[model samples]
Target: MEIGLVGKPNVGKSTFFSAATRLEVEMASYPFTTIDANKGVGYIRNRCPHQDLEVECEPNNAPCINGTRMIPVKIIDVAGLVPEAHKGKGLGNQFLDDLRQASTLIHIVDASGSTNSEGEPCGKGEHDPRADVEFLTKEIDHWLKGILERNWDKVSRKLEVVGGNVEHAVYEQLSGLGVSEAMVVLAVRSADIQESPKNWSGDDLYRLAKAIRMKAKPMLISANKADLAGDDLMDSLMTLGDDIVIPTSAEYELALRKASESDIVEYMPGEDNFKVLRDDISDMQKSALDKIESHMKRYGGLGVQQTLEKAIYELLDMIVVYPVENEHSYTDKDGRILPDAHLLPRGSTAEDLAYAVHTDIGKGFIRAIDSRTDRVIGRDHELKDGDVIKIVSK
Candidate 1:
């Protein structure tokens, strides 16, 4: 699944991207520093079953780090969005189009209220961060509405006169946005527009667009620059109540990761604290680390990792399943223990897992053996989190 990092310019979008993916992108205090979208793979931690199985895992797709399995998730950092972005303002269309494949989005807002609506540097607490949230959602809603309004007369006439399926037609129009037919149906229902498509009002269209965007591209809020934010500002963001707001310090996270890379500190992404590995460190570096530790202690580990994990595990409702060729030994054909980790939605069936492993394996139509229980299960059997199964294909 792809997670799009979105926000106004200089709200640490690039810094968050760099920290999360360990890939360098241009970062600056000015708006629109990122002209092109940066794509990279970021990982979410999962418990490696090999630890429980008492076997050394030779991973392939994902790496196992000290008993923790790091499952890769695609991350795209798009250009900074400005107000009226849907109206083609400030790299508007490009930004929205870049997020077409994103299953979800992480909105990085300056919680310190240090950035204006245009993403320019402003006085602290000058701009309300909550307004940033509203504006971004509104821009997306308008963008989707514009897409739906295109050829609306012809399409709506076809839908009403030809008695075509409304959900399917809408789904077709928004297929590029990763919108599913199921999402269209739910959006239509939630929109509660009883009128026929031909007679639907502008407001009705906007409502439908909003609903579709809600389901098609769910979002999590990252209240960035939290270290510089006051509790009152943080409290205001929390009162948003609709989205999950996480306080993050991307600068601090980047610093910690860099320090870890240099072996100056023993740090883990999600850990609340780090250890200074070298005693000969400069006083200036030591002070910076101490401040970062204090901030991390207050907000819980820089919030960079937490935001990513919440987007995947909670927002996406994904679970990791291991497919093994040898159920008894929990190894692939090459004798590597639990080599691959597949992220599947909660309630995915054995047949689905087979398809995920390979189309040929799924086409063969097989039974599966659960390594944990050694019980033979049919193709329809639903898989659970951390399941290790051997596909017995014909």
Candidate 2:
């Protein structure tokens, strides 16, 4: 699944991307630092594959190899959006097209309101971050509405043959928007469309548009620059009733990761603080690093790691399942233990997972054995997190 990182200009999109993937992109304190989309792999740490192996290690050091299983979720840092992005303003068509293929969007908001829509510094009291969210969401909804409006005549004609069901017509028209057939059915049902086209109001059209958007519309609010925003901002955000707001300091986290590589300070990305391993660094440098590190821990998480993972698993409801052969060794064809891990959608059955593994495995139509529990299950067995399954095919 691909997730697009989008927001108004200079809302730390590039910083979030850099921190999440550890790739260096041109991050400036200005708008449109990322004009083109930068794609990278962001990894989450699952329970160690060798955890059940009972290998011993020191505190803060696990015995398992630190290699991450790359599930290949494309993260696109698209160009910034302005108030009128839907109306061909501020690289309008380009930005929307970039996000057209994304399964979901992660809106990186400047909770501190340090920057304006143009990524310019404004007076402290003049910034309204909530307006940014409203504006961007409106643009997306309007853009989809425009697409539907343009094709309304053709779609309306098709409805006559399909029993005059506007929902079916709308789904047939919007199949290119990366919405799945099942999700389209849900969107149509939730839209409450009528049999007669004359009864459909502009509001109905808008609601239909919004539902299509929501099909791929799982968005996580990244309350960025939390260190600068303070507790009141976080408390205020929590009170707003958004379930997936994650406080993050992207810049500080990237710097800390850089520091770790240099061996100046031993720091984990999400840690509240760091341990100073060497005294050779200047006191001024150490103090600067310590301030950023401390800010990260108190507010929420250091980099975008915690935020991205929370968005993927908790907000998106995804689960990772390991497909392996050897129950004792937990190895794949290349003898690498749990080398291939598939992140499947929630409520995915064993048959669905079999298709993800390979068509042959799925076509054989057999059962699966949960290696962790040594329990055999049918093709329709529902999978949970961290499940290791051995497919028993014909």
Candidate 3:
């Protein structure tokens, strides 16, 4: 799953990316600082079963630290968006296109209201961050609307004349939008447009486009710059009612990660606090570390990790499953204990997981054994979170 770190420029998108992935990108105090997209792997922390199984796991593909398993997910930081981005305003055209690959978006909002609508720096609270919340989604909606509007007339005519499969026709029309025919059908239903396709009005098409964008690109807002934000600002943004808003200090996360890299302090990305490993520290560095500690005490961890975990598992309804060759050892062919932790959609079946591992394994068509009990299960056995299953195939 790919989560796009998106927002207007200079709202800490690059900072968040750098912190999460420990990969550096340009961060300037100007709009359009990111001209292209940067892709990297960012992990969500979970408990490694080895801690409970009384065995030490040799990590591969995923990272395990102090019994916490870090499942990596791809994150893309793209160009900033502005008002009427669908109309090609600012760097809107390139940025919107960059978003097509994202399964979900983490909108990094300048919750301090330090950036104006165009991402230009301004006094704190000058621009209401709540306004930033819906606009990006609307911009995305309008972008989809633009694509659908281009062919609405011709496509609707064909649908009306052909009169067999509306979903296929609409799906074909939006084949480039990264949505499926089932998604198109649901969008049409959600739009509540009961009339014939040819009879759809401009407003009807607008609603339909919005629905399509909603299902195609689900998003969670990260109320960034939270350290500088007032409670009133946070309260207002929270009232915008996405319930998925995560207050994040990208700057703090970056600082902590950087400090860890320098061995100045021992820190984990999502942990509530850190430990000063070395006693010999300068006064200035001590003050900075103390300030970070205070912030963590106030609002928990820096929130970069929380945003990612919520975006992937909560908003996207994903689960992590372990597939092992040796059920007892919980090891793969190479004797690596729990080397692979696959993220699958909730309710995925054993066969689906087999396919996820390899096409050949899935096609061979056999049952699976529940690792916990060694109980035989059918191909259709639904996998659950943390399930360790051994597939028996031809």
Best by the lDDT measure? 1
**What's the distance in Å from true for residue 230, model 3?**
1.3
TM-score for each of the candidates: 0.95, 0.88, 0.94
Candidate 3 per-residue lDDT over residues 325-367, each given as its tens digit: 9989989999988887889989899999999999999999688
RMSD of each: 4.5, 5.5, 4.6
lDDT of 2 by residue, 1-394 (tens): 7778889888889888877665322222212223344776665556654566543212111112233332334578877887788888887887898778777788888888778876677765358777677777778988888877877866676666555656566666676678766776787678887745545666777777788787766777787887677566667664555546777778787777777777777765545777877878898887887788567556645747777777678767898877776665676666656656677888988887888989998998678888888888898899987787888777
Q: Name the regions of candidate 2 deviating beyond 4 angstroms.
A: 23-37, 55-72, 161-165
- Minimum summed lDDT over a 10-residue window in model 3 is located at 24-33
lDDT of each: 0.89, 0.71, 0.84
* lDDT, model 1, position 202: 85
lDDT pick, better of 1 and 3: 1
Clashing pairs in 2: none
Q: Can you list the residue pairs that collide in candidate 3?
A: none
Prediction 2 TM-score vs. true: 0.88
Over 4 Å off, model 3: 23-37
What tens-digit string does per-residue lDDT give for candidate 1 at 299-363?
A: 87899899999999888888899999999899999998898999999989999999999999999
Candidate 1: stretches off by over 4 Å: 23-37
Superposition TM-score, candidate 1 onto the true structure: 0.95
